[model samples]
Target: MPQDDKISPRKPRRAWPVAMAVVAVVAVVAGAVTWRGQADDGAPSPDHPRNRGTELVIAVGDVAGGEFDPLKGWGSRPAQIRLIHSSLLTVDKNIDFVGDLASDYSVSDDALTWSFTLRDNARWSNGEPVTAQDVIFTYDTLKKDGTRFDLTFLDRMEARDDSRVDFHLKEPRSTFVSQLSDIPILPAKHYGTDYSANPIGSGPYVVADYQVGQQLILEANPHWYGQRPQFTKLTFLVLGEDAALAAARAGTVDIAYAPPAFAGQRIDGMTLQSFETVDSRALTLPTLPAGGKGKIRTNDVSVGNDVTADPAIRKALNIGLDRDQIAQIVLQGHGRPAYSLVDGLPWFNDQVVFEDGRTEDAKRVLADAGWSDSDGDGTVEKDGRKAEFTLLYPSDDQLRSDLALAVAEQARALGITITTKGSTWDGIYLDGKANAVTWGGGRHHPHQIYEMYSSKVIDSGYNNMPQYTNTTVDGYLDQALSATTQDKANEFWKQAQWDGQTGFAGENGDTPIIWLLRLDHLYFVRDGLNLGDQPIQGHGHEWALFNTLVQWHWTS
Candidate 1:
């Protein structure tokens, strides 16, 4: 199971008081007045040069409803939160870490303490200096609230001065700096429980106006320390996929997040941009049985799943599927076949190779394992037990549905019975009785390996859905977490995948998961709108499309 930051979907909160309603209405009226002042030709008025070629409308799939507090807010609303706040560090289009609020940083020789120096010109939107105390406050608040991030290793955070802060960790973690990219620093004095209603940050944009379920208006922050944004004003229109497509076709929206299925459609004046992402669709094979009935035991829990428990069977299934055909038919050529869960990542093991479907090789492996079509019924049986299992996928996901059917057809040719069923995520995954399920996740840190395959989290329900356990795997992951340098840690991560003799794909190791394909994010941009180059996306939400929002410009 992949460790995802996605929060469960929640309904939009609607408890605007009378005073806030009045303020919202007045803001609308003022906006209307300003619109009326524009020239009839839709050009800026001579008296208002600030409004010249400075407005843009973007159509998103959904609206964020909850508070913007990083500690309490869900990961689903990253677009809104990212625009209104600033993180200590940020990732560029190339997925490299870069300084955002902090100008530079250094780590001690022991790799347990990190020190950062803030830029002299950095300030909040309110013209107040962004000091080290604000960072300390944000971290302390989140630590106290017990946020989702695993911060138990943190020992203390102290402000050495107004512009300098030091963080001490109990153990060395090569990926600690990358983790900071997800935590936004808030203004110590202005931020509170209700700060989402009126967020004030040091980002390039400031919320000028907001209407629940309608739209959000952003104005340039004059006190921002980075390069000035090209557009002086930006409006995010809240709309669904259909409405967003309609808006794009009607020339009402400057940019829209287009679904992959609709990416090739010819919109009048829009150009579709496709970005590669770490988002993947894969099948998780249970190493343990649905119920307690197997020989393997951990924490007094019995593990079953006799069919997949055999390393030979798991290896046969891994190489028995035609991933290229699945990528072409199911993904419609929008993605590439995946052999590893963390494909294209820096820590991925490039030496591990998976061959295409080989019916003869698959049969040979099963025969050596004592499975044969003894009854002439076209189904393999061993020890009076049939080689079959139930594979479940979310009923609402067509991609998973198609892949499930494709996998079932191929497995049947090898005398393995795979029954496909369409079920809800809760009915299968949450119930913890699913034999197999289609799963995916996105993360910048290699710790994701531990989240999915570590024995420590097998029963925690947060990850390790397969209940996979291997002493060697656990040792490699533990050493990686404590490794003093990234290069050294990266070698451990690669070895954990496959080290020629023992690994996930090793002859004696359990291949608990089978990767399929990587999903690509698609979007439609109105002609002449330069959105700059987009970076490779990780497996989070869709807010990554706005990463280059400040650099967007209109030529027409």
Candidate 2:
């Protein structure tokens, strides 16, 4: 679970918007015991690693870019969200959000007003009782003003009493309850205005100590009402890939987050667990920027003009990429090629497949659009101007840079000169004229489409980089959200997908962005690490590493 879709204000700038770019990262159902060759006699294998009593040390992929403010960077990044914090509702692997703090909850008849009953027995680490005021205060303090990394979902929240709370919505939102899973309930007494320095939480783990950019130390909360963690201390070491891998190989780190290049390698006395996700690597077309400091263009236009506003161009660009090749070759057959943003979900429509990357068809499509070669140069020209553009991506993400280079290579063949530029995550989307970048995440759900392409989200500085808008798509989205039956909602959702591809929701008629490949999200763990009875994490990280943490014991 990459935590790509959920937006939080206090999140690390590097991981925020970019975390969602990976394609094909999805939550997987737990494998059955029979499938793993468990003996019917109830005898365990002699060499099987099971329940080794020891401390668990994890090495995260990158350093924290911002403070450990759960309200800030920690809210958006799945790794941080799952380990360092726990929300009011905990979602299963199947993406069904179950109760965490609240013992039970029910929706109003109209689905407009929702009420929750807090667990009377729940208590914070500081021995303060968990009450309705904590929930209300958490929402008010973190969500009311909104943050750069936080998602904008709540309209207002009110506490009816110490044990009950009511959420009043502006309109009926089917996903409102599920969305509450994004906010981690904080103690009202601790986190008002002066809580940033001494943050307190009720999750299984609490922040023991934090170094600005080096590491965050989390100790298991002995007071947690749920099952106690086996490890006394969980250390999240933040470092670059090289340092992280080195630490993992040396056994200085227990869990490590690294790229595929690192996953392919083996370490002695450790284990590797390769898991798949529905996260797709993609390129976002930015709204063209007019002018800014140290930047000026001969023709000044709105940011949307940079790219994604043209249907034909976006379609041609999408059709040109050889997604299959990228999947099989570049990805080593880890993932499938994607046509739309919806990457991996059982409900995903299989009818759509665009594998023409680096093909003559894509070149022809662009050529027919009045872009052609001029002056005998390889690149295309339109109206005596070279069809040239620059794309910016994060240098830290190898897949993004590779995808950009691949697109640039194909663009050259099509007479469209696309230059590739790499920068830090913060700078990639800074001024918005960078053109495009690659992103990935878990499973393709309708919520992903709404979040990425919805016309209503542009102002939030999210995935609507192309500034695409369409009534037909919006209508489909509305029907999908309001429909009582999943079947009817799915029907409308499928129609929305079709309409989106037909230019109703995308950049004109063609997708403003070409979904290159559904990145087969992978993670490595030590040998004999069996996660028993895991949940299905549809499109988020709730199910992948965090949920299984409770059941995971050293089986060495």
> Highest lDDT, which number?
1
Model 2, C-alpha of 396: deviation from truth (Å): 1.4
Candidate 1: tens digits of C-alpha lDDT, residues 309-338: 666667778777778887877777778888
Error of 1 at 455 (Å): 2.0
Candidate 2 positional error at 162, Å = 2.4
Cα displacement (Å) at residue 338, model 1: 1.4
lDDT tens readout by residue for model 2, 1-556: 2234222322322332324322111101111122123423321122232223445555555534335455554554443455545566766667565787778887777666778888776778676788888888777776655643333545677778898998876666554544466566777767744454456667777666554444456678777777876777765655555665665554445566656555577776566664556566777665333332222122232354433444545676766666776666556666667766664454354455533654687677767877767578787666665667777877866667777887787667666677888888666555344466565544323555666667766545445655556677778777776765445666666666665355332223446556776654455555565655654333332224666676777565
User: Global lDDT of each model?
Assistant: 0.71, 0.58
After superposing candidate 2 on the true structure, give the runs of residues whose Cα lies further than 4 Å from its correct spot.
1-53, 63-70, 148-160, 287-302, 305-309, 344-351, 443-446, 478-489, 504-508, 531-544
TM-score of each: 0.80, 0.81
